[model samples]
Target chain A: MCLKPQHYEDILRDQPDIGWFEVHAENYLGAGGAPLHYLETIRERYPLSIHGVGLSIGSADGLDTNHLERVAKLVERFEPESFSEHLAWSTHDNHFYSDLLPVPYNQHTEDLVCNHIDQVQTRLRRPMLLENPANYLELNDTVTSESNFINNVVQRTGCGLLLDVNNVYVSARNCHYNALDYMKSLPLQSVGEIHLAGHAVDDSIPDEALLIDAHDRAVSTAVWKLYDQLIQLTGARPTLIEWDTNIPAWQVLLNEMVKADLLLNQPPARLAHATEN
Target chain B: MPQKTDFHSRFAQALQDPQINTRPLLKPTGTANQRRRFDVYRNNRAVSLIDNLRSAYPAIFRLVGEDFFNAAARNYIDRHPPTGPVMAEYGGEFGDYMAAMPNTDSVPYLADIASLEWQRLQSYHSANSPVLNINELAKIDSAELVNLRLQRHPAFSAIQSRWPIGSIWTICTSDAESATSPAEVDMQRSESVVVTRPGLEVLTNVIPATGYLFLNALVQGKTIGDAAEPALTEDPTFDTGSHLAGLVALGVFSDINFTTE
Candidate 1:
């Protein structure tokens, strides 16, 4: 569930089967502070995952060692169950515009991203999860599909995939791709966790309102359906409800967790598809 | 190929120069009544930056109207993009930026207030290991006191200003209701404020000029005896007795490193 720093202890006091805790790795990157203090305390009890949004992993330039080292230290300190980052870049020329920007699906970009992922894993010395970004634009030509690119990364680096269901649904709707087709194409075996978030509709642009992945509201009627499809496909995996901005009360998140728990227990398809190999 | 930089270039353009981005983004065909498309990223970035500023400087935002604050904040972001990846640590130089801001010239004290805010944030995130015990300091003899190198908590920082920035910060964070006046501020007087985290929470206290000088020296490689020179010059009545006790109480000192004189 999307948790506030203030709510760390109280949430822990009443732990309700949270699969793991996802913290903005930057929050605890400092050498010493209560943020780190509480996170360390919580890490003692709950399984933790570092979800970084600012590493700019997909950038063409060399990977940010400073950022990597900070994340590395956090990994060393927390020793989280699984760590993850986006398939998007957030900065250029030192100006840190901390928002996830999409990358084109092509051989060159894949090669670049794979190298970045390799560096991250090598530094942390653990398998990290790469998430599918919620794309806002789609182009006519590409060397590979989004799922194909992800599969290649998994094949290359042995990194796991954090399939953000809401992101896929958002990207698919914004870019006019089949959400089911995208999920089906993914290497389901590489899937480690799932993220469910809320999105908002933009008002300015006509015929193409921005599908903002703002996690303030409830999982849309559409997203819930998509989640069901994913669960049946990927089976029960670790799930997180990420509400970053406009965080609602605690009960709101619990409700979402309960919803996910209900879906997890449901049986998967009887026939496990044979490997292509 | 140089085209490999396409991801980097396009992502950069999307961030600072979205207009240059000819790259086709996923267009949402179904929903369009109220949803703004590409503008979503821009709005989100702006909102995120502004929200971060609000958290960093609630008092300043409170002082300025939302409209004015936002307008200034947008300009601030354009000029001083965050070099650090962490958004909370983004506006480290915002106070200095605001002071030199051509537009925010009206609120002369705004910069000082921003300085106070910045210090508070530093205290919030600075490293605070266990303090050097009071008994530990007492163990040092006159013979071993020279060349003592002491390190303080990372959560500790001192800011001295002409304006009553500390009082203004105190009043702003608390519920004083009405706006503070400069005449009431005694801006002609100099003030130094130290921000530290004794426990889990951040605490800010106004320090005497003597205390500021003394700590400043100690933070440097000054010997305990050498550091006392600054405080004695600043105040003839400077008491090392209660002063050292206060530092210990605040979890300021970490350890004492000594070298032969």
Candidate 2:
């Protein structure tokens, strides 16, 4: 479950039966306030996973040392079970765009992303899980497939994957690729956690559909099917129900969590097993 | 092949500038299709930042109404994109930005209202500290008490505005059912506010001119006696003793330190 400020009182009062909670690292970066105060209180009970939305890990300008230091301090204070960032960039020169922009997946970008990941890992003294971005359009400079790009990053940097299934579904539909094939091509063995969220469709172009990773509603039926299929392959990972926008009531989010929890507990239809002669 | 930075520079420029065609950046496609694809990012960048500003300055948003606030926000967005990832610290210049916009003179108090809201936000997020109690001053010697310097709480801030900012802010932020009408506001009156969040909830107190002067002097590292001089000069009947006690109750001062020499 993702912790939102609106749900703070509910969580504190009910002490709901949740596995753990995830929080956007940037929200708690302030000096002191009700946010930090409640986070500390909640963390005392539930395990925390810090997911950063603004790290801009793929920025070509290298990492922002000042922002990196602040994130490092936050991680130390919380000591979350895992820390994750996106494979997209949100900054150029010195201006932060506040939206995850895609990076061309070629040799130059591969090297740049790997170097930035290495710096982040070294500073934090921990391995970070890199998430696959939800792409709306492909850049002209692309020379490799998205899976290959992610595989190469994992191979070179040894960072785990935060496999967002909704992104896979959204990007696959938008970029004209098979979601199953794309998911299978990646380094599934490195997946440390999973993310499931909602998306909105933009059907403006004639005879075309583009799905935006809006995260503003309930997980779509197709996304749920994909999640179930993924659990069969990956064999039950820590899953999060991400409802960032148009956040519903506490009961609504908890219901979504319960749905994922039910799927997580079910036996995988076909386990990954190697045959021996 | 364009280098990583080159691609980023061009892409970033296009996101901000509407006239620049993204066809040059995207994979070759129909002109309309290229624009439709690129509009997603452009819209996300603008809407997300605007939402951040709206959350930070709800009073400003309500004062100007949605259409006007969004226009001002869009103009401000182009000129002042956030320099970092911390959204809470992103709109530090929006008040000044709104003040500089041309047609904002229609609501001259908009900028000062923004400052009051910004101060409240700063008070809510600033570091927490142990507040100084009035009883703490009893330990000090009477002769040395006047020479004592008081440290302002990390979450304490004072704003002096020409418009009745405090009243306007209260009406804008309060529930609509009980909110005072805008016509009831006295535009000629000068208002000041002292924001403090000694606990979880932030409190905004309407203050007088002498209070602002005394607090400003303390903020500049002036001793109690020196700070009182200005307040006394402003109003002959200024009572430092009771005024200091009131501020202490409000948790304005965090600590009292005396010059070691």
Candidate 3:
């Protein structure tokens, strides 16, 4: 969710069952203001997850102590139920690209990711879940599959996986991998939270391919199908409705929240109906 | 492979130089249009930094139009990112960066404005202190006044500028005014602003050159007599009683300690 400071009050009032609120950690790093104040207020009412976009966990360069310290400080203040970051490396040399650029899923990248996870968990004094990237390129021919790479990070660092179903669809479309196969390859025991967000189709790519996780619109029917598959494979995990850009009305978000609840508690018969329909 | 420092390692690198090769670091030839994908990231980093600069110095952005501010902010972000993650401290050097900007020579006061805004944030975040009462200060006689070593509130900041800076900063940050005439603002004119968090809110109050000098001396841990000298030199009409009373009423200081030495 874009989770604007202005919208928090009305959202809590109108939609009390929204469960939890997830926010970009960087937005609240300031000393004091409406953003921090509102987040603190909302946090009192609901659980929160500190999701980071700037960590660049898969890069070859060393972790940024300054950024880690900021993250650690926030974790201390909020004492959030969960904290998560992307699998993508967003830096080259020492500069940081703010976007979650996809990482090559090789053994080296895997090891690097695991090490980064260890540092974050150590600094935060808590476990963090690593989310998958929405791939545009196939990434590495020599490296292990995406599932294996994610599993490796989870195994080595004892971190949890924030399996984004929409990402599975986006990557599968981008690289022509089967979404079902991607889910099946992962060690399901490590799965913690589930993510459902919107993805845009890269019009330039062939085979109507290349889905970019823009999180601007409603979750597409195809992504919902993939979500059904994952939920059936691994039942009853906490799901988040992520809409970062082009945020719609609170009702629209509530609709997504409703969808999330449906999938989580939706029984097998209902799951079949939810998936089939 | 180097030890994992933290998540910001790669993000910091990504912001530095775009051409630096990540081929050795990432998985080989995994998909198509790596450049296109990377562009999305490059765009995001640039945008975040630009947005941060605006947030840090809203008044400065308002002085210049949004278009101009966006351009200046972009340039500053590329040249200097937070060497540390605390964004409050990230843009502290932005004042110098703005001053050095060749294009910004048109607006000489922009840097000072940025500095003032940065001070506002510093004042907002600084350690909180309780206000000392006037009754306690009344107990101090002439000898104690001469030897006082006052404690300043953490959220105390002083900014001096050559332009109608305080007025300009106020106009820029507030919605009360519309257009500003660059001609009306004399380049040689000087003004000082003091940002203090007396209570829960941080306030930016316009101060005279006298007060600026006086406060600077106090900041340096000077005796009350020593501080009065420079302030007197700066403004012969420097009204110490009025200013001191006003500051006391505003709760700008805590305990005013007196030492015999």
Candidate 4:
């Protein structure tokens, strides 16, 4: 569950049975404040993971050095168990777009992403995970497939992957591809973590259904299926159920985590049988 | 066959301006409709940015109501997009932008209220520091008291406004009893407020003009005696010892340095 100040006392009071906590790296970049204060207190009890949304790792213009330094500082301070960022870019020409944007999967894009990841790992002195993006539009001139692009980056940089099953489902449904095929094709062995979140269906289009990664509602049934499929293949990795928008009550979010834990704890034989059919 | 840069540039242009046609940039994929897919991204960009502004300026949102605030925020975002990824620091310029907006002419005090909210935000996020105490002053030599320089806390800010912004902010943000109408506010009364976070909780105190001048002078590295000059000149009845005691009690100073001169 995403940490908020209003829920801090409750979290400390109840101390829910959670595996770990994840925070957006950008939110804690301030010099000092309540956000840092609470995070420091919470870190003493629970293992922390730093998930970066503003790194813009996929920008063709190259990574922002200042932003990388800020992330490095945060990593140094928190020393989180895991650090991850998205494959999509949100910044260009020094302007932040406030959303993860799609990039054409091609050799040029692969080289840019690899070089950016190398810089981050070098500065941070730690390996980071790259998340699969929930894409809306597919570039017509795209030369490489999404799976091949991610696999190539992992092979070259030796970085781990954050398999966001919800993103896969959203991108697949919107782009008209088989979500299972996409999940099955990814380099699951290199996946160090799993992300489950909710998405909203865009009803703007009359004929087609477009699922936007809104992270507002409960995790969709289809995403949970994809997540179960992924866990069957990769086994239980560190899983985080993200709820950024329309954040539900702490108990409701905890219930989602409980659901993920049940799936993660499933026996291998049972998961194998489930995966078969 | 556009290059990656050309494609991104065109895509960003389309995101900023819905009127721009991005169909030429796409590769002409067979089945799926590109326009509908691209519009989702456009809508997401606008919605997310507007929501961020609303979160940062809740009091402003409440004051202007949702429809007007959303309209102004949409216009402000299109003109001044965020230069960095820090959403908390994104709308610092919103107050100035609102002041110049044509629709805000009747509500001139709106800008000052926005400024007060921004100061509160800055104070909330500023660096933590150990506040100065009376014991720290006692440790200093009495002979050097006149030449001592005091540093304001990192989370300290002073806002002077023509309108009673402190009361206005309190009324807008709190659930306590307040005047039923905006006309109840006395616009002729000028007010100064000092915001400081001695601990984790941010406190805003409406101070007299003398207090504002004294603190402002001290923040500018003026000595205690020098800082008191303006305050006393403005208000001949101002008591330096009492004012100093009150400010110190408020945890305004973070450090005290003795001057060699």
Candidate 5:
């Protein structure tokens, strides 16, 4: 579950049986505040994962050393079990975009992403997972596919992949691709974590159904099916139910976690056939 | 192969300005409606930044109402895109931005109110440090008290404004039914406020002008004698002992450096 300040007390009071807690790294970058105070308290009880949404890893110019150092310090302070960022870039020429942006798949971009990931890993002195972005536009055509690009980055940087299943479903629907085929093409062995979130359909484009990754509601039935398929294939990596916008009641969010845990604890033999094809 | 930098530069330009046509940058495989799909990023970028502003300045949002604040926030965001990822640090310039916006002459105190909110946020996030105990000063030699340079706590800040901003902020944030309207506020009355986070909670206290001068001077590295001189000059009856005690109780001073001649 994504930790919010309002839910901190409830989390401590109930102590839900979650696998781990994930926090946006940018939120805790303050020098000192209640955010850090509460996070420290929560970290003592629950295993924490630092998920970065603003690293702009895909920027061609490269990683922001300042942000990278801030995140590195946070990692040093918390020593979270895992750290992850996105394949998307949110910054350009010193300006930060508040949204995760799509990057073109090509040899040049692939090399750029690999070099950036290498820097992050080197700076943090540990492996980090790169999440596939929710793409809004397919920018360029070249030698590398999205899956191949991610696989190449993992191969070159010795980093892991954070498979955000909602992103896959959103991208597949928005960009006109088969969600199952896209998931199948990913290097599941490299997936260290998985994310399940809600998305909304953008009514602006009436002709074509464009699913925006809004993260507002419960996980959709179709995305849950895709997640189930992925977990069955990958043998249940650590999963997170992310609800950033329109956050539900704590019990409701816990219900989603219960659902994820149920699928995660499924019998191995029953899901073994998923890897056959 | 197109240079990655070239493609990213164009993409960034398009993300900021919807007028920029980036259809040439895309692959031919996707549907012909790539432009409409691409506009999604632009919309998300604006909406998310506006949301950040709204979160940071809820009092301003409540004061101006949602539609006006959103319109102003969108304009400010386009002009001043955030340079970093931290949303808390995103809208520091928004108060000044709002002040310069059109049709805001009617609510001139809006900027000062926004400034007060900004200070509250800064105090909430500033570094936490141990405050100097009252007994610490007792240990210092009486003769050395004049030259003692007391450092303000990291999370402490004093704001002085011509309009009654502190009361305006209180009215806007508290129970609205009994609150006085901003228009009824005395435009000529000046207000000063001290913001500090002694513990986990951030407290904003309205103070006299004398207190503001003393605290402002002390924050600027003035010695005890030098800092107290202004408040004394402003009011002959100013009781430095009581004021010092009150400020200490508020956990304003974090350290006292005794300089020996």
Candidate 6:
């Protein structure tokens, strides 16, 4: 379950049955106040993972050293079990757009992303997980498949992957690729965590509907199916239910976590079949 | 073929200006329109930033209504997107932006209200510290109290406005369902407010001329005795003892440093 400030009091009061909680690292980067106080207190009880939204790991100009330092200090303070960042860039020319922008899959981008990831890992002194981005439009210069690019990044930087299942489904739909085949091609063995979230479908264009990784509502049935298939391939991993925007009540999020939990406990028939074969 | 660096610059340009098309830079899928596909990035960039401003300035949103706020916010986001990643620290200068915008002149108090809201948010996320209680002030001899140099808490901020922003802020920040309308405000009056988060919740108090003068002096590192002199001159009836006690009880000061000459 992703820890939200709205549910801090409830979690502290009940200490709900869950494995661990993930927080957007940027939200807790401030010097002090209720966010830090509550996070520190809650962190004492449950395991934590620091997820960063602004790392810009794929920027051509390289990483923001100042932001990286702040994030490094936060990682030291909280000592989360894992730290993760996106494969997309959100900042360039000293201006942060606050949206994860896509990067082309080519040799230049592959080198730039790997170098940035290496810098982040060296600074933090811990290998971080790089999650694949949900692309709305493919860049014209792409010379490689998205999966191949991710594979190169993992192999070069020696970092794990935070496989966001919904991103796979959304990118697959938008870019007209097979989600299962894309997932199968990646270095699934290096996947450290799994992300399941909801997306909004934009259908203004005639034939195809573009799926926006909105994270605003409940996880769709299609996304849940993709998650199940991935789990079958990767076995049980530290899965998170991310509902960042239009956050609902505590029970609503709790129900989503419970659903994911039920699936995690079940044995994968595919794994059984593979062993039987 | 555009270089990787060229792609980023052009994509960033497109994200900022909708007029610029990403055309050959983006490959259009079979049925998907490239412009519409690229608009998702544009829309996401603008909407996400606009939503951030809306959350940061809810009172402004309420005063101008969503349509006006969204349009104004779009302009603001285009002009000044955040330089860093911390969303909480993004809108420090939005109040100044609103003040300079020609369309917002009708609501004269809009800028001050935005400042107050920004101050409240900063105080909410500011560093925590142990507040100095009134009992601490009582232990000092009356003579030494005159020489007391108090350091304010990290969460403390003082805002002075020519319009009745204190009253307007109170009305706008109330439960939306039961909020008082902006028509209730007396547009001619000036107001000052002290915002502090001594505990978990932030408190905003409207201060009189005397109180404002006294707090302003202290903010400039003046001694309590020096601070009170101007307040007394501002209003002859200024009761220093009572006002001091009130500020102390509010936990406005975090520590009493050594007296300065």
Best by DockQ: 2
Which is the winner by DockQ between candidate 2 and candidate 4? 2
Provide C-alpha RMSD values for all models, in order.
3.9, 2.5, 5.0, 2.5, 2.6, 2.1
Least well predicted 10-residue stretch by lDDT in candidate 1 chain B: B26-35
User: With candidate 1 superimposed using the best TM-score fit, by how many Å does residue A237's alpha carbon deviate from the native?
Assistant: 0.9
In model 2, state the lDDT of residue B229. 94
Measured against the true two-chain complex, the DockQ scores of the candidates, in the order shown, are: 0.48, 0.78, 0.24, 0.69, 0.74, 0.77
The residue-level lDDT of candidate 1 at B192 comes to: 83
Q: Write the per-residue lDDT of candidate 6 for residues B100-137, one digit (tens) a residue.
A: 88877788888889999999999999989988888888
Model 5, span B48-150: residue lDDT tens: 8998898788788887889999999988998888999999898998988988888888778888888889988988888999888888887877677768888
Model 4 chain B, TM?
0.88
Question: Which candidate tops TM-score?
Answer: 6
lDDT (Cα, tens digit) per residue for candidate 4, span A1-277? 5676667888989988777899999888887878899999999999999999999998968888998999899999889998999998899878899999988888888888999999999999999999999987777647889999999999999999999999999888877799988988888889999889999887765777888898888998888888888888777789988888888788898889889888888987876775564
For model 5, residues A126-227, the per-residue Cα lDDT tens digits are 999999888877766445689988878888899999999999999888777899899888888899999999998867656777888988999999998999
Using DockQ as the yardstick, the better of models 4 and 5 is 5
What's the number of clashes in each of the models?
Answer: 16, 0, 25, 0, 0, 0
Residues A1-277, candidate 3: write the lDDT tens digits. 4466547778667656666778878767766544576778788888888888778787777677787888789889998889999887665565555566666666667778888899999999889998987776554333567777877788889999889989888877766778888888887767888899988766785655556778889999988878877877777777888887677878778788787677678766765554342
Using DockQ as the measure, what is the rank order of every candidate, best first? Answer: 2, 6, 5, 4, 1, 3
**Candidate 4 residue-wise lDDT at B4:** 47
Rank by lDDT, highest first: 2, 6, 5, 4, 1, 3
All candidates in order of TM-score, best leading: 6, 2, 4, 5, 1, 3
The C-alpha TM-scores of every prediction are: 0.87, 0.95, 0.80, 0.94, 0.94, 0.96
Off by over 4 Å in 5: A204-207, A272-277, B1-5, B29-32, B135-147, B175-184
Best of the two (4, 5) by lDDT: 5
